[model samples]
Target: MLVQKNVPLQGLNSFHIVARAQALAHITSEADVKSLLADPAWASEPKFVLGGGSNIVLTGDVKPLVLKVEVLGRQVVGETAKAVIVEAGAGEDWHAFVAWTLAQGLPGLENMALIPGTVGAAPVQNIGAYGVELQDRFESLDAIDLQTGETFTLNAGQCAFGYRDSVFKHSSSGKQDGGYSPIGLKDRALILRVRFALPKPWKPVLGYADIDKKMAEHCTDQPTAQQLFDWVCEVRHAKLPDPAVIGNAGSFFKNPTVSPEQCTDIIGRDPKVVYYPLPDGSFKLAAGWLIDACGWRGKSVGMAGVYEKQALVLVNRGSVDGPDGATGGEVMTLAKAIQTSVYERFGILLEPEPVVV
Candidate 1:
């Protein structure tokens, strides 16, 4: 394990915003994490865990020890007639893991082909793309409780996953009290590894509207797992900006779910409004459509602008000097504007998916 002080976090995050970490450590093993927590230098210091740093916006410098989980490995732990249980280290790149699963002929994760982040952070947000979510294949995960320096396992049910949220994000308080609070500087835990049960016979899903249309146009009657993966990658690449060139964190907000009555009311007013009926009987409205209808796409406030192709994504096109040059605040302002506009137009509220820190 290597510990560095005053590390620059500009390149660590996908937003490409500059921030400084008071102390940073790369933990290769659980023992290193335990030892670091026991050190007096970090006894009272706040702790933060980082994976790929894909789904976060750093408002300013972090005053805690940012422990980067570097543990790596993947193994087939269990198998059944219907599914195969695959376990991966938390530090494994999320897209790499998806590709590895596709190589092994696993069926479930093909729809989430090119998502950015680490395997560990996948369950943290119950990440979903196209028509699939992590909870669809999640079995369990292991995480270290920073408070007690103890390792704990969380099953799918224990994860408390909602739309882009989980226990690792919603649990814990700054001080020890029975009050609900956001996981902030004083209360955060580290994800260690995740276990996923992928289907064996590979039942490919072409559920999302865009995916279905693309497959239909390509004459794909029954697409294979590899075909689905390839198509998803192509679609995402065509629509979303490559964070490597343009700074972004994928979709900035989640599609707001509304009741059936609310959906009917909204559709009654505007017949062209697009919405998908979820399996749970809720209606998932098109957040991008709402934002685009409000004339936000390609609109820039200062350094941040909505991606012209995908209204859900906010890009940082400002100077790359430092915090002053970053457009984190500009993105938030646009997001808030979209949220307020959607609410005023349709009485539906849009919620941001990324962790705004």
Candidate 2:
């Protein structure tokens, strides 16, 4: 375990928010975790697990001891006639791992190409893109209990994945009256590794508008995994701002899901509202479309601003190389303002996607 104090977290997070972790520990192995637990000075202290720093906003200095997961490895652990089971350490770069799977001829993750963050964070957020979600490819995951220092594994059903959410995003004593028992692992579990089951009989996930446009421009109906991967990357580059260049978390809000009645009402009010019907008959409304409809694009709140090209993304307009940057408060204030406007117009609340620290 490599321990450090008063570490600057400005560059660690994709948003480039200026902040600090009072105490940060680099855990490269399970042994590192065990060592930290055994130490009297650190054991029993409040803890926080940090992954690629892509899907988080630091509102201020982190008070908990930050465990920066850095364990790294990737390999095909097993294979059957139908699919290949690949395992990767939690700290592996998600996009790089997707590319590696393609290099090895695994095709299931192509639709999610170019997503930022570490593999461990994928399951927690149930990250998705195009038409595929992490839950669709997840096999199992290994994690450690922060409070007990115990290790365990969980399968897909145990993760309770929903749109942009997972058990890992909730607290332990979650609501129990929603026709099922609530199981939230939020702030109590540190994911150590993840496994993916890539099917042998690979089929391309198409029909997304942007993907359809790509196919039309390319003049091809059948796209290979590599082609799909490349297309997704290209489309994302043209749409979403590169975090390295602009300092923003990918998508700022979850596409709100509504019933057909609600959809019809919204459509009646604004026929141009971008939406998609889900397999379950619910309608997914485009958050960016709502924000843009409310005239929030290119708007700013102090150092935080909405991206001019894509209203779905909130960006840091302040300096990336220094202490002067968008405070988490500014970003949240802007986000709340956008939310209020969209709600006032569309009668639906927009849920933020990033974890607020």
Candidate 3:
């Protein structure tokens, strides 16, 4: 039930934006949350769960009570005919968890190696990379209701996973249409732990261009899970700046999806537009290509700058540990400008991926 006041948050978030939490608390276990809820001091206050802090942008000093998730555990929970159930605490580093899975001989999560953030935060964004997504490996999850303090479990379907989105991203208050809830958990729930169903018969997820290049370079068609993990890490390191060094929140925008006709129109204008056909008969335009096409690479707004190597990444050009770091406002300003340019050029509004606080 201990609460710290005026906690510095620049180190917590990947963007390294200068900010602070008015009050912050750590939840290392479910009992901690229960205890906090029972206290009159915090029971009725609005709360925001902070995990690895890799997927958020702090715009200013956070006014809500920041509950920094620090729960920890990892084990093989059970086994099924087709897969094995593995559980990890919400606060566990996502990349480390992936490595742990591989160390235990699990293969499905290898394709998602090196993705920043915590395991609990993964479902909120339905985090994906290369050719695989969290939904593909998710079995179920246990969460606590912030308002009621009741623990509950939900299966994959309840998550309502979409590209870099899930029920967790929406607010609980939404209009009811066709008997379906539009607003989801949002700030009402705190994910305590996540269970993944790793495949029994291991197989590598291939065909991604960067991965293919690795395969071609190695001259090995049949790659192991460890190899895939190494290559994914290599590819990511090459494209994205380390948040520990140059502050960043990975890809700044979601690759916008459009109708086939819309893709055709864009292609007619610029044949070099990078896109991929979805199984749903839609096309996903590379947001990086659009940003690059608009000539935003290496551009800056204040201390915020677009990565010289990848237009998809927005970086903090100033010192992270000092007073000269980029503010969340500057980051958002740059992001909005890029969005405006991409929309004007390609007739598509690129959505930002990071959660803006």
Candidate 4:
């Protein structure tokens, strides 16, 4: 329950933005949250739960009591006819968790390998890659109600998952389904751990051109889960700048989903628009394509730049170890500029993926 004051956050966030938490506390268990809430000085304070810091943008020093989730563990917990249940601490590295699952002969999560962030942060956005999403394998999660300190568990149905979104992303104010039935969690819940139902008879998810190229290179139509994992990691590395070398928060914007008529209109605007049809009949336009079409690739607004290889990723062009690196303001400036350019050209406003704090 020790709350440290003025903690530097440069080493914590993947973006490597220089910022500090006014006061920070680490929680390793449910009891930590309960204890913090029981304290008169901090019980009534607003709080922010921090994890791997791979999916956040810190505009400035954090003012709320930052709860650094450090809870840790992972194991195969149970089995059923259709799947094997696995449990992981919310604080576990998401990529590490995926690798561990594979080491245990679990294969369903391979397509989502190398995604940056913690397991707890995964559901907040229903993280997906190649052809798989977290919701596809999610089972249940244990969390604490920050408002009342009540421990509760939510199954996938109760989670109300959708493309890159979940209950944790919204507030308690009458937010509708797609995220939750009627109540949204947003700053009101703190996840402790999560459970996943890895498919029993694991099947590979493929068909993306990047993956197809990998398959072609290997000269195999039927690829193993490990192969899929390695390909995903390779593709990501080739297209993205590692945060260890360059400051960035993966894909900066979400691929916008558009109606059929809208897609047709965009196609008329540019016949070569990269898009994929969803099972629901809607079309998802590539945000990267839109940005690249706007001629933003390798462009910079101050110290923040659009990744040359992938227009969807805005990067910090400044020295990683220097204080003159891209500020949060500069990153947002570039992101907003990209958003505006895309909207003007295609009538689709690209939504940013990171949680701007």
lDDT of 2 by residue, 1-357 (tens): 568999999989999999999999998888888899989888899999999899999999999999999989999999988889999999999999999999998899999999999999999999999999999999999988776677877889989999999999998733344422338888888899999999979999898999898899989999999999999999999999988888899899999999999999999989999999999999999999999999999999999999999999999997776777899999999999999999898899999999999
Per-residue error (Å), model 2, residue 181: 9.7
List where candidate 4 sits over 4 angstroms from the true fold. Answer: 173-182
TM-score, predicted candidate 1 vs. hidden true structure: 0.92
Worst 10 residues of 1 by lDDT: 177-186
Q: Please give the CA lDDT of all the candidate structures.
A: 0.82, 0.92, 0.91, 0.91
Clashing pairs in model 3, backbone N/Cα/C closer than 3 A: none
Cα error, residue 82 of model 4, in Å, equals 0.3
Could you tell me how far off, in angstroms, the CA of residue 56 lies in candidate 3 after the best superposition? 1.2
Model 2 local distance difference test score: 0.92
lDDT of 4 at 228: 92
246 Cα displacement, candidate 2 (Å) = 0.9
* Tens digit per residue, CA lDDT, model 1, 1-357: 457999998888888887888889998778888888788777567788888888988878888788888889988899988889999999999999999987877768989889999998898888988778899999988877676687867687767777887777764544334422334312466778899989767777767777788778878878888888888999899999988888888998888899999999988998888899988999999898988888888988778888989998988885444555555677788778888988898897888888876
Model 2 alpha-carbon drift over 4 Å, by segment? 173-182
Whole-structure CA lDDT of model 3: 0.91
Q: Return model 2's CA RMSD, one decimal.
A: 2.8
Cα lDDT tens digits, model 3, 1-357, are 799999999889988888999999999999999999999999999999999888888899999999999999999999999999999999999999999999998779998999999999999999999989999999999988888787877788878898999999988644344333435989988999999999989888888899999999999999999999999999999888999999999999999999999999999999999999999999999999999999999999999999999999999998878889899999999999999998888889989999999
